[model samples]
Target: MIKRVHVLEDDEDIRYIIGVLLKDEGYELQLSSSFSDLKSKLKDSVPDLFILDVMIPDGNGTDICADLKNDIFTKQIPIIVMSADDKNKDKSLGAGADDYISKPFDIDHIVNRINKLLVK
Candidate 1:
């Protein structure tokens, strides 16, 4: 099965870039610009992995990550939290994110991390 990745990022350019790259890497991609959109998407189907921005227009990624981890339905999904602010690293990890990527993230690194997580 093609692995599905859902990304919650408010930056249009970054969302587009990640979507394109993940698609090219042979994974299915769903992109959401806000927490509301992400929630709506979740109602339809869960993704194999999630990439969330630390600070989004409607919510905080770490909080979302924690919620997902705590939920029975989503707890097994690997989450990768991203932020321009490196200070959010500890918070993201504490929230049960499988990985944290700092922005201006290297695309290869994100891809590699996703691969590693999905392989588990």
Candidate 2:
């Protein structure tokens, strides 16, 4: 099955980069800039995975992660919380994120993590 991944990242360049990377890797992509956009998009379709930024424009990514994890519909979807701040790693995990990747991250690392989680 072709897996779909929803990404909430405020930086246009980073979002574009990830979209291109995932699309090339044969995963379906849904990109959103804010929590509201993510919520609206999810009403139509739920993704197999979520890549969220810790600092988003409309909401804290950790908070969003917690919300998703608490919901029965989205709880099983793997969530990777990323941030430029390495300090938020614990917070991300505390919020029920499956993984945490700090910014300046290697593209391969993210892709590898996605592959690993999707396997389970």
Q: Which regions of candidate 1 are displaced past 4 Å? A: none
Worst 10 residues of 2 by lDDT: 111-120
If scored against the real structure, what TM-score would every candidate get?
0.97, 0.98
List lDDT for all candidates, in order.
0.95, 0.95
- lDDT, residue 38, candidate 1: 92
- Writing each residue's lDDT as its tens digit, candidate 1 over 1-120 gives 899999999999999999999999999988999999998999999999999999998899999999999999999999999999999999999999999999998989988999999993
For 1-120, candidate 2 gives per-residue lDDT tens digits of 999999999999999999999998999999999999999999999999999998998999999999999999999999999999988999999999999999988999999999999983
What stretches of model 2 exceed 4 Å from their correct place?
none
